[model samples]
Each structure stands twice: as structure tokens, then as C-alpha cells.
Target chain A: MMRRKLKVAVFKFASCSGCQLQILNMEDELLTLTDAVEFTYFLEASRATAPGPYDVTFIEGSISTPEQEELVRRVREESRILVAMGACATAGGIQALRNWLRLDDVKRAVYPNPEWVKALEHSKPVAEVVKVDYELRGCPVSKERLLSFIKQVLVGRKPYLRREALCMDCRRKGNVCVMVAKGIPCLGPVVQEGCGAICPTFGRGCYGCFGPSIDARPEALASRLREIGMKDRDVARLFKGFTGWSEKFRKVIDELEGGAR
Target chain B: MVSGGIYSGKFGELRKLFNALRLRGYRVIAPKLEDSVIRLKEVTSFDEVPYGWEDIQAPGKYSVREGGKHFRHGPDAPKRILYPPRLELFRLRPDWSVEYPKERFPPTALFAIKPCDLASISVMDRVQGGIGDPYYLALRKKLIIIVENCVEPGATCFCSTMGTGPEARDGFDIAYTRLDDDLVVFRPGSDLGVELLSELNIEPATDEVLRKYYDALKNASLKAKAPFELERLPDELELGLNSPVFKEVAERCFGCAGCNMVCPTCFCFDVIDEPELDGGAVRVRVWDGCFSYTYAEVAGGNFRKDLWARYRHWVLHKFAYWVRQFGVFGCVGCGRCITWCPAGIDLRETIKSVVEWVRSRGGS
Candidate 1:
């Protein structure tokens, strides 16, 4: 097997920069990662940034502003492969919850001068702006999975990312089903796997930080949650967590919030 | 059918069997209370077993309280230990040859396992073994089963309807039935079980005590409620393939395959050749099921593209297809699928719905 010399870049939009920090958090893998690819533009780790047309680019955060919308489109053209890294980049993160509110009302509640707020109508994923080659889903992308994705890319293999629901991983870990044992409503069954059942392992329902699974049925889960004593708004709020702006979840949130205060 | 002489022991004597198995180099996997639920995990000593703990199971509810029978558990199936959720079939070598994993399975004893779970392994033998699944067969060979009679069946359990539970008839080395009178009837069904029985140093149960144990077993079998029988289930499912009940069920089904993951006899898997970080590609098979979005996907497209089709396929496989494929119903009726479903879609109700739909159409 032959190894190819690859240059990598990192970009960020509107986010807490946690996903960008995850690259730096790879303390042990950084050595092997350094050996695998040249860091051309990882602003979080290095000060000296290189020019574009990079081999691979990891763009973190969501497109929340017009400037970010244009920037993401530019980043997509400048890279051989553009990978959306984290919930904000892939499904608009927790900040995207602002999508549910009326634009004027939301602006009035948050800012003193509502007219000066230059945010987009909705905080959208990078895919909504430009084409994304790959997506690493989570609130602040899993460092382990990101490392494997990079390694697989270096080997010219399509990385096998698990698209199964969080409940499957939860069951595999032998964590007793929290929703069944307790009456707590969980979004695990509709949420995609990647976080390794972090919330359910800690005896809490999943907040769906990793976004919807491929076979997400929010309507099914929302109805079941209602049976277990959650109001429509409560169930809607659960789906409206991190990845509420995603298509599958957005429709359900719309239907659920209908007459659901 | 090996009805060996029954012996009586106190509630404390089960530890001796746990110890005897450990002395024989077997890891004892038993029911232990952890994280507010009973887990079928490996226990080094008998103290880890959740004694006097009773599990409450409903369509979507599962919780444990300390008051009743100790040999009860929920959701966590024994199929996981035999045919693990994720198994590496082989590694693809450089020359396009394959290298099987050089892993060894330790001889393990499943102590105090309910009879329905034990029957599931028997179903797996016919399914996996008939299909020549080496991993399950090898793991099955290394297993030592110690069956425990389930006297206090959970609300979701209908093993009596499945006719696989409340008593262990065969395929187990040792069987223990705890009576309400604080005595346990121990029976050895194999040579190894008889040797382990010798460690107890207890006399054979008298005729009176044996009769009492038999009566208790019979009474316990009657304790479980049977919602329906398996005799007409296969036909009903097949005849009602277009049943509206399936679409109705799908409306509430998450199609997450949580039911399939916890299903004891579910043997479907997806094989993928993944490139290792070390440059070698390994072929691994993880637990996949009909409910999966890509489970039925082929080159052109997916077969069960709709959730209704997937849900119908899952129910039909257990009730209808397995009977045709393996000459046995895939469902042992342990009700893990019923209990663990996040959406609370009761399989028993789904079956009933299908039956009603079929009958309403005059198809069955």
C-alpha cells in the first residue's frame, strides 16, 4: 500500500469552536495524524495558514450569516473534498433552534436593536449552502470517529460511518433501556448513532445531539412520548434540540408545535 | 427428556453451583442488579446475583424492585453472548485470501437463565447451525447452560403461549425450580450436571417434596397469561400481507430495529469489509435487521422501502417465515422486543391486530 501526501485545512462559521478544538484534543493521534497529512490551515492549532485547493478541508459550524453563506460556498470550491465536521456544520446545531421562533420576535427577545441583527432567517447546515463530501455528526464531533474518517480518507476508502439509531448502540452497550425503565421520553430511537449512547449510559434520555438517523421516525417517537405523559410541546422541544433544523425533524416540529404551547 | 432424580436445596445453595462452575473454568453469567435494572452480566461470585429482585415489564415499561423472585430479568437477551452483536468474520489478506479471527471463546455457564431464553438458543442451533454459522456453533459448544424455572412471569411474558417456558425439558445441563415454600428442586440433565450436583452434598428429594415441586411447576405455567397461540399466526400473517393493521402498526413503529437487536433468535447481519488503520481490511458483520433503512437494499434499490413493509417483514419472519425456514417459530416469547421498544409498540398486540384484520377479511 502506498501513502499519498495530502494537505488538510480547517474552517469555522457560527459555533462554540468545540468541534475545531476536537482536532487539537487528539493528543495521542496527533503524532500519527501529523505523519499522515500536512496541516495547511488548522487555525485552532497553527498560526501560519496556507492557501486553498487543499486535499481535504474540515469546515465546522453552521451557516448563520450571509457572510458565512458565501464563505462556505468559497471553501467548497477551494478543496478537493469538503467535510462538514459537527452538528452545527451538518444540521445547524443547538443555535438552529432559533428557526422555530418568528424572526422579529426572536430578534426582539435577544437583541436590543432588532433591526441591526444580520443573522440569516435560519441557521443552516453546510450542505444547505454548498455540497459536502462527508459529514461528521455530533454537538462537537467525536474525536475518535473523526480520526478514523481521516485515516480512511488517507487510504482512499469510503469510511463506514454507522447510520443506525442511538438505541441500537445503547442496547449493545447493555445499558438498561432508560425510556422503558423510567417514563423519561428519549429521542434515541430517531437519533443517529455516533455519540456511543452517552446520554442513555448516564441514565438520561438522549437530547438528539447527533441529529436524526437515516430511518428517523419522529412522529412515531413523538406519539409514544405523549402516551408516557409528555405534552406535545415537551416532545416537540425534545426533537427541537440540536438538530431541529434538519428536514425530517423540522416537519415534525412544525406539526407538533401546531396548537402546542 | 432426561428427567433425573430431583433434589431439594435452600435458597443459599445456588451459590455452590456457581462456585462449582467457576472451579471448572467456566465464567458464570447470571442476572445482576445494576443501573436500576437487572443485567445478564458475568458474575465472579454468587453475591452479584440480584437475590429477591423482581422485574416489572409492560409494553413499554421496565423496572426492578426488591420483593419477589430473583431469577427474573428484562430486555438483555442471551443471544448477545452466543452470537454477539458485532463479529469479525475474517480479515482479507494481501493476496485476496482470508484470515479468520484467532479468538477463543471461554466455556461459560449461563446460571439462572429463564427457560424462554434457553429455548432461544435451541432455535439458534437450528437456524445458525443449519446455515453453518461457525461463530455461533463454536460459541454454542463452549456454553454450559444452567436453566432456572421462571415461576413469576412478567406481564409481557407469554412463554406459555409459545410453549417454551415455565419449565426446562431438555438441552440444558442443570435445571433449578425455586418453589414458594423456600426450597429449590434441582435436576441434572447431563453427566457434567450430575458431577456438579455432587458438590451440593444434598440427599435426593423425597416423593412428597418431588410431587410438591412438580405441582409448583405446573401451577407456575398456568400463572402466565396466553394472549394467543402460534398455530394460526403464520397463516394469518401470510394471508394478511396487505392488512391495514401493518400500516397502522407502522404509524407508531420507529423502524429503529431496537426490537431486532434485543431479539434472541434474530440472526440477520450485514457484512462489511472495513480497512483497518494498520492497512489490512477486515470483514465484520454487525447485527442488522429488517427495520434498518438499508437492510433490504440491493444494487438497484431497497425491497422494504416503506416502514410498513419493514415492520410487516419483521413480524412475519418470527411468526411465519421461521416456521418455513427452520421448522420452529423464531419467537420464544421472552418479550424483550415488547419491553425494550421505545415507541411502546407491543408485538403481541400487533399479532392480534393482524389476526383480527385477517379474520375481518375472511382470508384465514
Candidate 2:
């Protein structure tokens, strides 16, 4: 007997929608993916909205509003598996940059009518509000990894990720060490392995787009940067990019500042 | 102690031995002079050897010249075998499905490997083959190494500090030391080496002959320069990390990944699925670098946006983080990164800067 196709839905909240665009960018694999799973709701690709009981739900963006907070909770209730797609859904994305500053200042800077703007002070990942079964990391998740995750989930298999540092990928690509040769500051060691170590290939250092990796000793890395002639402010600024609002990166940055005197 | 074996007639006799081994189905690879570099190339005869030649190497320059019949190796002479700039790790189909290409792993006999090059291979083996990489293990399993003691260490070499030298130590299957009058001293380091020597039908050496070989090798090791003080590295690095030295060095950085590419120990990689027009795709692992801006960036944005953070990450990983995780220092003191860096960013100077900065900051 043929079983019913798995109902999948892709949801977005407050974001640039780049993660969804990355999904659409998987042009070659999209047709095959569509044939394999039932995409019941993907508003970025379709205007049609479906209600309730999704087999799998991929959530992008972060919770920046009270409505989104409630909506995420209801979505979690209806979905059997909730997967956070991209850094926004997994680590609060760049919008979380506001997490470091004062709330009133941000409200005044962005909204003409602060009283009408019903917004949360800080941007937050889906996991802050609801449970997440899986997380596809990166500012925009790697297409290879995204497809692999989808296929693995469909087949009920574990998708294995080589969670080494970006340095490993850098070394494998045969790129000269930008730090050693060019003295460029890089984040290949503490950053997670993904995106095929692209920046280093084109003569640039890693920018930590994948967020803080497992056991990413950023404090030690920052200290090393200082030895190599980097300023404390530069180090602080480095951790403040992309995943700056993440607890791990924030703590590392705070620690670099000597624990706020 | 010096060791001696009977004169195996002409140097051509060694070629015959290689050919005989090949006839017996052993894949023979030897150092051949190609485009002024002593590259490991497959050869069937003695004529293919880099005869009557030697190499000169320094920062940003490499040249091999004829007329020096003495088997001298240049430290800067591009160690292509130990550090292949590019290797087809695996081929992929258009689709993401992967197929392990059937590699011809014949019983390989690597001839005329210099001591420094030999030591580099051992270091790489400890990282790639020793750490549960069945792939590297397979390649290593079929390899037979022949270490040739360098007559003169290259100008850029500092193998002595890393405890590698112009003389062979333990890892080789066979060791050779060049002496006066075209006489080569051979020491069998393994049973296979002994077997190969026996097949040559060379007479055993007297104690006096053996003594000469040791004296030659000992002198070579002594002649080599010492590497940096590796013992003080971890603490020095810790102290250095907070110093103002990085900025000065980073100012000269052009963000080129040449240093990592030339290094034998740098083994980071990235995996990608190459989708085919067909329903299948091949997943291939390729070399990657940390210096690139996108190495850590995800879909939304980058994390280590600054050049300072990225550079610090690379050095710290090599010195501090790798030691913490692997229980060993990541660098092998090859100095290739220093010599190959177009900007001439010397690693020794960088370390010195770190040390000075730490001292100024009152760091221990």
C-alpha cells in the first residue's frame, strides 16, 4: 500500500527572505524535491495558504513582533517536526544586532510612530519560543546541505555534518593561508565548516557566516588576534557581525572586553 | 656506527633494480627533474633520474641546475610530493551522488626522497593517516619509502629544530647516504628493505664502512640550522594573542592563501555535491582556505567580517586551538609559509612581535 506524501511547509517571519530565496535558487534540484515531498505552504513561492497538521515545517526568520511570537507557537503546535532554516531562525539572524543597543533608541530610529509599532525589543530565534527538531545553519543555508537535510528527513536517515572548523575546508581547498602569507585576520578556526570554505578561496578570510561552531573558543581566538596586531575594538566588532546576538559570540565578545571592567 | 654494502656497479644498476621491481609488478616512482623542479614522476629506467643536477631555493625563487652530480636537495625546491599544490581527490558526477573512482594503488617504491622531505611525509602521515582516515591509510599502506640523506641542506631549511634532519631516522623502509667515489651506504630499516637488498646480491658491510656512513649523516644533521623555540610556543602564543603585534603584521597582509597551499600539514577541506544532468550527483571533498571572507559566512551575512579576526583565527588554530584539541602542535616548522608568502610575512617575525607585545602588556 502507498503511503500519503509528507506535507511540508516553509514559513518566514521578520527577515530579508534570503533564506527562502536560497531555497528557490536550488533550481536544478527543486523539481526533484517537489516530486518527493508535498510542499503544502511556502508563501515565498506560492500565495496559497494551507491550514494545520504539517508533517514537517521549515521556519525562517526570527521573532521580532508579538504576533509572530504567537504565530510561531501555533505553528509549532500544528507541525510534527519544526526545522529552523538559516541563521535568522537558528541564531536570530542580523536583526538581532539590535539586541546590543537600547530598545527605545531603536524604536525611535526606525518607526515614525513608536506607539503604533507593536514590536519586540530584541530579535530571537524560533527555539527561544518553541522547540526545534533540526537547524540548517548559515546566513543563507548551503544549498547542498539544505537538499541533503530534506532528503535525509524524507528517507528517515540521519544527515551527518562534518562539524570541523572552516580551517579544515580551507586547507583542503589548497588556498594559501591568508593569515600566514598575507597577514589577513581570519575566522577559519572557530567558525563552523560549511559553504565549502568559499571566502578563503577567493583571497578573503572567513566572516563567520555559519555562526559560532561547536567548541568555538572565540575568546582565545580574539586574544590571538590581539597578538597578531588586532585592536580590542576590532575584535569586538568582529563578534558583533551576523551572529553577534548569539549567546556564545556575545559572551566571547564580553569576555574580550575584560568582563566590562 | 658506519655501515657498508658491496658496490652495486653503476648507478644504472639501481635503475635495473627499479625496473626489475616494476617487472615484478611494483609501481616505481622516482624524483625526476621537470621544469626545474625535482618532482616525483613514474619512471622505468635510470635515465629518468635527475642526473648531474641539484636545486637552489629561497624565498620567491626556485631553480635546478645541472653539473652538480652530487645529490644535493634544496629545502626551497618545491616539495611537490609531500605538498601537492593540486590533487584530484575525487571526481564527481553532475548529480550529488558520489562514486569512489577505482584508484590504481600499486605497490609503490618512492626512490630518492630527501631526509627533510621524508620527515615531512611522516608528519603528514601522523595527521592524515594516523587519525582514522582509511583513505590516506590505504595510500600509505602500498608505499615503500627510500630516504636519501641530503649532501647539503638547502638555504631555507630548518628541519633541525623540528627534530627532522638531513639524515633519515625511523620511518623509512631504506636509508641511503652518499659518500666519496660514487659509493652509497644503504641501511635497511625494514624487512622489505632487507629483502630488496638481498635481491641486489650486495655483500654486507664491515664495521669501518658502517662508521663512515654514521659520521657523514651526523655531520649533516649538525650542519642544519635549528627551528624556532617550539617549547615556549603555547604560552608565547597565549601571551602574544593580546598583544598589539597583529596589527603591524596584518597591515602587510594581502589576504592571499598561498601559505596554506604550500604547507604540507595544512589539511582543511570542503565537501560539495556536484549535481549531474542525470538523477545522480557526486559528492567530492576539495581544498578550502580560512582566509576567504565567505569561509564562515552563511546565507544571511558574515560573522568574522574583519581581516583581523580571520587572521587571528588562522594562527591561533595552528598554535593554540590545534594543540588543545589534537594534543600536538599544528606546525611542523617547515617555513614554507614564510618562504612562499609573496608579501614575505615571516612567521618567525610574527611570533617575535607577539612575544614583544606580551612583554609590554606584562603578560607571562
Candidate 3:
């Protein structure tokens, strides 16, 4: 008796498609993954689209337009479980920096014909528009993490996401503290563990691509960044990265904008 | 057999010890300077040990330079070898068969270790050894610890305050103090140390050279400081439990748990069940800290929900609770926490805050 193959769908809105690319980067494991699940609707990978009612739907971008908003809500209704993948789906990626600016000015600067483009006033994560069952966060999501998520889902077990800070991974790897040793302002103390603290392992500071962890004290980290000679606006800009629109990081950006920097 | 003999040799003679350890089939874990950071990693060659390079460590600042005559300190500790950050305890298959992983405890020599780290090993021996953890105990038994006494302690060092360093009294099989770039003084602590030193083709120490070595040890002690006396620390921490200083320090703390990660005596761990799609589960253990927000969490809610509460728990556990638990302070006062913390939050300042809180009420 053969078990039914899980029907999976990958959707994108306004992202670089890097997170979706992680599926192809899975090496020989991609073949193993294909055997376990049928890719029902992957627009980037294939032109053929099957109507949803997907077992699992992976949303890869933020809802920056009215069409994406409608699609995400319908995907939520059609899927048993909807997982928002990458920084855009979890916490509106770098595009959310426009949330601080005038929407018309942002559109005019990016597009030659501002009237031709269609976008909402502010880009929002999938959770803001529709309930997201899970999130695999990163600028470009980790191949290992995505595989682990699928593996757990296949086993009918809840996927365990890490709540620890990126610094924990850095410490475990016995990597020298770039922020402490080099005076580089790092967001490892606030960002969640997912990428295995890759930046710090290479003697560089973490750029907070994984968003805030359970123990994130952004105000405390922001103040530390300031004490290390980072200018007010630069500190604000530092927090305004991939996960800037998230609550912990958004609070820092909001406070800085409110003249607390 | 007489133990605790002081011997003298050329600096290059230490290389002979490395050779002998390898010949005995022991992996030598020595300090190797790589990419500017001096790490206590496995080295096949003695030349890998950065002899004359020392690290300048301060609150949130560390760098390596050539002028210093002492061996530099790094973030890597001997604990990683004994009690690793992540380990698979066992695996349970679908057939209900348990597969225990082979012990990774190889015969290893901890070569050229500092005094503060030596003290940590002895402390962990009691902490983990007391509980009779098979892995840690097995790894501990296989170690050939060699200590390098601090002639010039790093900026973050406070081993003297903790009575753990500048000169290692015990815990190491063999100890050495660099007299200069070439000349060296050796002190044997155990029977194996005696055997190793006795076989050495080196001269006996003279009174004049020993005098100079003693002076340097004394000088190293004077350089490291404590905010106040630590004799009444547990009582002081008790009095300052409800004080505002913990909250004040927590304000600056990023809750990264950098201090706990770098601290020599921290031993908390979290157990996780990693179930595979093949119907197998691996019971894994990874390092955990009180400063972590997820610590003390249950099904209903987290016990230490606020960052300040977690921060207070860590400080109190190190100073007060550890005294009650192990009859010794959990913190060895190595100051690795201070040097490694991104926030530059110094425990010296935090300890002083506790003392100030205790003094404000005239309790002292």
C-alpha cells in the first residue's frame, strides 16, 4: 500500500525568488523531496498550474499589491497548511523600508512611469494579510532548514523552529566575536538562529536577515550600536534591513524616527 | 616518588612534549593563531602555537599584536572538548532499537593552557564529575593537561581575584612559565608530570631565574583586580536580589547570553528530540543559558518572561546559588564574558552595582 504524495505549492509575490531557488539548491535531496511530495503549483519552476486545495503552500514574498493580497487569502483558504518562506513572507523584506517614506515618492523613484505600477501603501507580511501557519525566515532561506521543515511535515510532526539568537550558534561554533573583537555592529544578539551564524563565522557581523528571536532586546542592541560610534541615522538604517518591518525591529525604527536615536 | 618538581628548559623544549604526546597516540589541543584569533584547537605541529603573541582584551574589544611576550587567549575553551555544544546522546529506530553513538573521547593532551581555564577544568570536574556523567568523565580521564602560567595576563583577566591563576596551584599535570622568549620554568603537579619532566633533557632551575619567575607571577597577580572582596559575595547577592542594579544592567544587556557561553563554569543544556521521516529519533543535547528568553519555558508560559528577570537569575545563580549548590562560585572570574560580550557589559561593573546596592543600606 502506497501512501499518498503530499501536494505542495510554491507561490511568489514581490521577491527576488532566492527563497524559491533554495528548493533547486537541495542537491540530490531535491529528488528525494520530489518522491515524497507532488509540486502542484510552482509557477517559477513550471508553466502548468493545477487548481489549489494544496496540502502545503509555501508563500515566498510579501503582499505589496492588491492581487497578492487576494492570492494569499485564497491560498490560505485552499491549503491545509500555509508556510510563509523567506524574509519577505515572514516580515516584509528590504522593500518595507518604503513604509517609512511617502508611497508616491517611492513609486516615482523606482519606476519611470509611477502611474503604470500597482502597489499598496505599505508592503505587509503574509501573516498581516492572511494567517501563516509557519515561517522559514532569511533573506535567502537556508537549504537545510527548508528540508528539515518538509521532513517534519511529512512525518505529521510540527516543525521545530529555533527561538535562540544567532549569537548562540556563533558561540557554539567557537567563532570569535566580530562585534566584540572588531567593534563591528552586529545584529546577532537580536536575530533568530537559522543561518547557523554564517556571517560571524567568516569574521563579519550578522546583518539580521533572520529577524528577531525570542530573546531580542532591540532597544538594548540599538543603544550598544550607538555607543560603538554608529550615527543615529546609520543605526536606524542598520535595523531597517530584511526583517525591519517586524515588530522588534520596527519598534527600533519607529523610536529612531520619533527622535530617540 | 617526589612530585611538584620545578625544572628549567629552553622554550623549544616544549615542542618535545608535543612530539611525545603524539607518539603516545594523544591528540594535542594547543593554541593556534589563525586569522588573527588565537584558538585552542587541535594542532599537529608545535609551530602552530603562537608563543610570543598575546591578545589585548577589554570590554567589547580584542586584537592580536606581536610585541607581547605571553601566549594569547581565545574564545575557545577546553569545555568544548569535554562537554561539547551539541551532541547526539542516542538514536531510537522505528523497530524500537536504540543506537548509542560511540564515545568521541579520544586520548587528548590540552597543551599550553592558561591558569583560568585550568581552574575551570577542575571546577567542571566537580560539577559534571560529581553527577557522574559518563561522557564528560571519560573525556576528563583521557586528558593530559599542560598549563602555561600567565606572565602577562590579558586586559580582561581576573583570575587573581578568583584565586585561580597567574600561577596554577593544581589541576594541571605540568605547568610552565616563560622566563623570556627562550628560557622556561616548569612545575610538575602530578605523577605523570614528574615522569615527563624527569625524562626531559633540560637543566635544573637556578635561584636567580626562579626569583625572576616569582616576581613576574606576583606582578601578574597585581594587574588583575576585583571591585571589592568576594568573601561576602553570596550574602551580598542575597541582599541585592530585589535591588535595581540587575534591572539596570539588563537594560544594557542584549540577552545574547555571550557571557554564559564564554564563561568557564556554565553547564546548562537543553535536550531536543529530532525525529526523522524514516521513523527514527535522535536525542540531542545543546548548550542552553539562563539569559536565553526560551529558558524555563513550559507549556503554559515562560517562567522568566522579562529580559530583566532572566538577567537577574543568571547573576544570582552565578554568585549566590552556585555557592549553595557546589560550595564554590560558578564564575571563575576569567573575564572572557566581558571581552566577548557585544554590548561591553562588564560583570565587574555589575558586581560593583550589587555591592553598591548592598552598601546603600549600610548592611556591609
| The candidate that achieves the highest lDDT relative to the unseen native structure | 3
**Which sections of candidate 1 miss by over 4 Å?**
A102-117, A259-261, B1-3, B89-101
**TM-score of model number 3, chain B:** 0.97
**Candidate 3 residue lDDT tens string, B1-364:** 3246677889877888778888889999999998788888999998888976878888888888886788646888788888899988999997769999996778999999888888899889889999998878988998999999988888778888888888999888999988887888988888888888766767767888889889999999998777767888889888888889888888998888888788878998888777665667788888888888776787876788888888888888988898899887787777888888888888888888888888898875
Model 3 docking grade: medium
For candidate 1, lDDT tens digit of each residue in B1-364?
A: 2236888888767878888889989988888888778888899989888877788888878888887765475677888888887888888775667888886688889998999999998998898878888888888888899999887788878788898988888889999988854688889988888888877856688898888887877877786655677777798789988888889989998877889888998887888776655566777888888788877777776777888998888889899998998899999988888888878788888888788878887887
Query: Which 10-residue window in model 2 chain A sums to the lowest lDDT?
Result: A172-181
Determine the backbone clash count of candidate 1: 0
- What C-alpha lDDT, on a 0 to 100 scale, does residue A123 get in candidate 3? 89
Instruction: Show where candidate 3 strays beyond 4 Å.
Output: A258-261, B1-3
Tens-digit per-residue lDDT, A35-110, candidate 2: 7677889998999878879989989998999999999999999999899888888888888888877777888899
Off by over 4 Å in 2: A1-3, A257-261, B1-100, B104-164, B169-220, B223-364
DockQ (model 3, Cα): 0.68
Ranked candidates (TM-score, high to low): 3, 1, 2
Best-to-worst lDDT order: 3, 1, 2
Model 3 lDDT tens row, A20-124: 999988887777677788899998788888997999999998899998898888889999999999999999998988888888998899899999988898889
Model 2, residue B85: distance off in Å is 14
Question: Candidate 2, DockQ to 2 decimals?
Answer: 0.05
